[model samples]
Target: MGKSDAFKALIIGGSVGGLAAAHELRSIGAEVAVYERSVGRTQARGAGIVMQPEVEALLANLGLSARSVSVELRERQQLHIRGKAERYRAPQLMTAWDALYRALREPLDDVCYRLDSSLRHVRVEGHDVTAEFPDGHVAQGNFLVGADGIGSATRRLLDATSRPAYAGYVAWRGLEPESAVPEDLLDLLSGRFTFFESSGMQMLCYLVPGANGELEEGSRRVNWVWYVNLAEHDLPRLLAGRSGRQFEHFLPPGELRPEIVEEVTEQADASLAPQFAELVRLSDVFMQPVFDLPPGRILANHAALVGDAAGTVRPHTASGTSKAFGDAAGLAAAMEGWTPRHGLPLRRLEEWEAQRLSHLVRVSEIGIELATRSSLGVPQGDKFFASD
Candidate 1:
């Protein structure tokens, strides 16, 4: 049999990382299928991302045009603790999570992607991998990939020892249309990436396309994030839903309690500048408790972990998407270099393990530093600390 016909891959998760992995594996001549848990479309957080190089390369590989989907910011403005704004000449391509999702999803074949399917368990028989689904169906393949996000059931099965530990803070994210807010506010936020950092807290904002990927001037939306420290004991109170159940992951809009939301708004008004605080107060808000994942190898059995399922660097690194792209690229390269009987996935996995471990260390460190940057510190010497 030809290499193309020799193996099949079953992928868990259909977000960006999973989709990218599907595309890359298919290109390397493996039969590929993706399994996602949601019945409807993915409800992304609508947050903005600084498109790192790895993501750009993935887009180029698919021959997709990003101009219609992304916004290019020519400079960065940091609101210093001294009550002054400093503009840096760092340019970046920024896009919403939903926009990037659609751009990447459009190019993938619909036939191979499965929604409303979740992994219940996996059975490995020598080199063969079979995934058991909650719906009582089974899919067997030569390779299996777990691209599920941080709450990954795959990570639970493969690497049970590593749990997502709270990182002492949470990110409050919001997005609003340009027309929905005041004109002066839009002018202040448009055309540049802006950040406000104070006593270990940070607020960052940028512009991105509107709902359904609309990218016109006034049609676009503004995306912002506020990173605030919350004591560990108080997290459950904020995560309490309408049903009163405390959640550890993300909280949907309806589940957000009125009292907690009101309290957060009051805190914003008190702590943030009036203009910036108004921006947070006026917009819809949600919470994501930050977590730290120390780096590790993703390969195990004939199955591998792809994207966030593998490891998650803090959002401060801005390398979350880029790291996922690199994982997909590295897997494709290893598969392409395969030689029947002579192929040693173990050796290849070892090489990838070392490379990604080192990569995540550098990335996570930079993220920690940025998240904790203080005005009391030395002048920003190396801009590398601010890179993706």
Candidate 2:
């Protein structure tokens, strides 16, 4: 599709990937519409995400600058095992997911974003795709993009074989402002990345500067995530109490297990150095499931899968958002002059799939290996960050 083609494209899901696709399509002169299931102005859900260079590059290509999101770029990461420090230098970033989403949604003006319009089904013919919403509304477009998510309606309507498989672990994550945090912990964590490891669990912590480049009240906050292994039978108790009260671990703006919170606090108090322990003591905690989806490529007439919708890798690599944005870029490039009638060039789609599959496979393999090693109390050493 050339710039003068005037094609209409419909993107399902209004998150990062969907918004990026919408922006990319609009840049190419295609009329675009985004259907998101969420209602108006709900905060972006999820914990802090590490946006690497590639992700930053993609956002820049979409006309989104780093200043829009208060990106915190780090040059060094410190690893602590049994209370000793081991440091490695690498280029990484820490930022809230909601902030990144808002940044991406800022530059789009021509795109029509429809909230609460969840996709009900998709009918793809030889030269066009029709998307049906649950409210009996139908949208027709020259092409359709499924940026929905792990449980995508487009994926389900297209390929019923692909399913998300649980990776047998869950993550507890949260953020706390600097004022709420203690001074000693602030000194150790304010300027760099840090990780603490122990048997059967691990904690990753880093400083995300406030929106104004200062760590003041209601501005800068420390982002933390704790990965814990869960047995199958214990899932219910962890998910909800017997009284139907949801067991809160990592979802922000919710209650946390007092006992679990105190246990983690105590662990930091006794097992960590003074600076690191204070970071934990002064911080609030949250938790979430750490699940991975099956690995495979989805082949459709005029649609393709990207990011977690295709497959999910564990966050230990912190590469999900990066992969999604990268996938969007590739799809935009591949379909530059293609259409539903002729379909995206088989070779080009295959190439995109190959690139995404190779990266995601490596990430999943490393996640499994690390999970096993962490379970066995094996030393990860400095090589963990080296692979990136």
Candidate 3:
């Protein structure tokens, strides 16, 4: 491709991040293609997500909106064992990972979306970059984006030394069907983002759309997360499911190891409030180890990284999706600035990198601070997102 050729942006990974990238690039009149490793639908267990403005803005920009797939929340509460509680009332939007994915992925044309296509590597030669597939299919584009998430192959190829480190805590997460939620407990969790915290541990639950994206009362699901400090050495055994197969990614339901479940149950019973313990006992749970990825070397050799592939944020900041949305917006702006007058637009790319890295640093720093504050019985504070 010549310097004056039409812009062709190849996006790796077709999840929320990559699809968002495609949407932004297409808006700028760039040729876009998304290569996703997963063949069909993809979902994460314990997938309740708190939506942010940036994500909502992107959806608006793409002329797409979440449909029948989210529950609007009105308050945040911290319940005490003595039955007293403190409430922080604010309008919040929560949805499932599946809902967010559907809202973002359904808009793109299928012809340019290559499912079951995994990016094995990328070779940058002169003004163009070539993406190699495992099946030997090669795609050439003017620039490349790595949005394949935390275990990103593009990140590996782009910065060979990047590694995701364990964050010293594991979140035991699950969803309780409104049907399964106890008659008494339903009222407490239904309309609010509720949390219960103890020294070195915290538990929170709030209502979200049901599996079918139902929003009616008694049909919505209550999503819960319990954070505990689990040593890194024990992770290997925990990764093995009842089938004895140690999966690399987060374990899906039924595949969670019985021992880990038992451990969580015991911990909940011993350390958690009675109602919370029962919630833990009845719900099928999944585990995710937290990690802090310092922003480093995201832009290099005609490519950039987005979303978790860029760097993951601890959920405490409630900025994971926002960060991804910001990356997509930044990339769109950078590409649009690449005119003949500016040539390669290297300065825009660098400015984009600086802005994104600063945001990641702020979120990650708050996440680390949250660990210290969890012992104080509040995982996050009002000034949380405001500080950065």
TM-score: the better of candidates 2 and 3? 3
Error at 176, model 3, angstroms: 3.0
Minimal lDDT window, size 10, model 1 = 379-388
Q: Which stretch of 10 consecutive residues in model 2 shows the poorest summed lDDT?
A: 379-388
Q: What digit string (tens of lDDT, one per residue) describes model 3 on residues 157-225?
A: 998899888776677788878899888888777789988887667788888887777788888888998
Clashing pairs in 1: none
TM-score of structure candidate 3: 0.90
**For candidate 1, what is the TM-score?**
0.91
Displacement of the residue 118 alpha carbon in candidate 2, Å? 2.4
Separately for all candidates shown, the number of backbone clashes (residues 3 or more apart, or on different chains) is: 0, 10, 0
Relative to the true structure, how large is the alpha-carbon lDDT of every model? 0.77, 0.67, 0.78
lDDT of 2 at 211: 37
lDDT of 1 by residue, 6-65 (tens): 578888998888888888887777778889988988767437888887888777877866
The numbered model that scores best in lDDT is 3
Candidate 2 lDDT by residue in tens digits, 69-114: 5545454555565455666666555766767776677776556888
Higher-ranked by lDDT: 1 or 3: 3
- At residue 373, candidate 3 shows an lDDT of 83
The segments of candidate 2 whose C-alpha lies over 4 angstroms from its true place after superposition are 1-4, 42-45, 63-91, 209-218, 241-252, 255-284, 339-343, 376-388
Best by TM-score: 1
Error (Å) of candidate 3 at residue 269 is 1.1
